[model samples]
Target: MDKVFIKDLEIETIIGIFGWEREVKQIVRISLEMSFDISKAGKSDLIEDALDYKKIGKSIVNLVENSSFFLVEKMAEEIAKLVLKNKQIKDILLKVEKPGALRGSKSVGVNIFRKQ
Candidate 1:
């Protein structure tokens, strides 16, 4: 299947397991690779025939920015559920990372796969 992807989409929200983390919002980077067949769009060469990636990305960013969660795992699951609402997507590879969450690590987070 063909894929549509967005990388390093950052949004600020309260996310963590600690007391201090719940008090402040931190930036979380998100990456999503959605499996979608682009054949129709490619053939029609029309924006209407294509998957509206910008709209999808904006919705996800808005959702994440407005919500608070203690775990990235839960966040990932929620995002997958929301994205899978689009019937065009067959599966997805989703990654959520909190940069600087670990002292020596570049970033820490989870990667999850969801299928329709």
Candidate 2:
């Protein structure tokens, strides 16, 4: 399947199990790889024939910014569900990362793959 990817999308939100975490917004880096067919768009060179990634990104930002989730796992699942709402999407690979979450690590996070 043809793939469309969005990388290093950073957003601030309330996410974590700690009391302080809930009280403050933290930055989370999200990346997504979507399985889609690009043949029609490539052939016609028209945006109307292609998947609208900007719209998808905006929707994800809205969802994450308004949510207060304790785990990246749940966040990822929710994101997958939202993206999968588009019947044209065959599946998605999503990654949600919290930078500086661990003392010594650059980041900690979850990677999930979901199919429509």
Candidate 3:
């Protein structure tokens, strides 16, 4: 299967379980890998035959900015579901990072996979 990926997508949104966190927006990094058979698209060399990554990116950004989640796990799960819902995607791996969530650690987040 061919793969379509988006990496280091950063978005600011209201997230976290803490009261202070809910009151403000925090930066989250989202990375996604989706599997699809793009041979047809490649052969045709048509944009319409291929997955529109720009649209996907915009949709994800909207999803993150317009919603609130207390945990990265939930966010990751939702993203996974969204990807799997697309018929072209056979599977997906989603990683979400919350930078500076811990004092000593660089970031904390979750990685999840969903198979269609």
| TM-scores for every candidate against the unseen true structure | 0.97, 0.99, 0.95
Compared with the true structure, what per-residue lDDT tens digits does model 3 show for residues 1-116?
A: 77899999999999999999999999999999899889989899999999988988988999999989999999988878776778888898889999999999989999887897
- lDDT for position 36 in model 2: 98
lDDT, residue 99, candidate 1: 94
lDDT of 1 by residue, 1-116 (tens): 89999999999999999999999999999999999889999999999888899999998988898899999999999999999999888999999999999999999999999999
Measured by C-alpha RMSD in angstroms, how accurate is candidate 2? 0.5
In order, the Cα lDDT scores of the candidates are: 0.94, 0.97, 0.91
Question: Residues 38-99, candidate 2, lDDT per residue (tens digit)?
Answer: 99999999999999999999999999999999999999999999999999999999999999
Show pairs that collide, candidate 2. none
Clashes of each: 0, 0, 0
Ranking by TM-score: 2, 1, 3
Off by over 4 Å in 1: none
Better of 1 and 2 by TM-score: 2
Specify the highest-TM-score model's number.
2
Could you give me the TM-score of model 1 versus the true structure? 0.97
- The true-versus-predicted C-alpha distance at residue 32 of model 2, in Å, is 0.5
Residue 81 lDDT (model 3) = 77
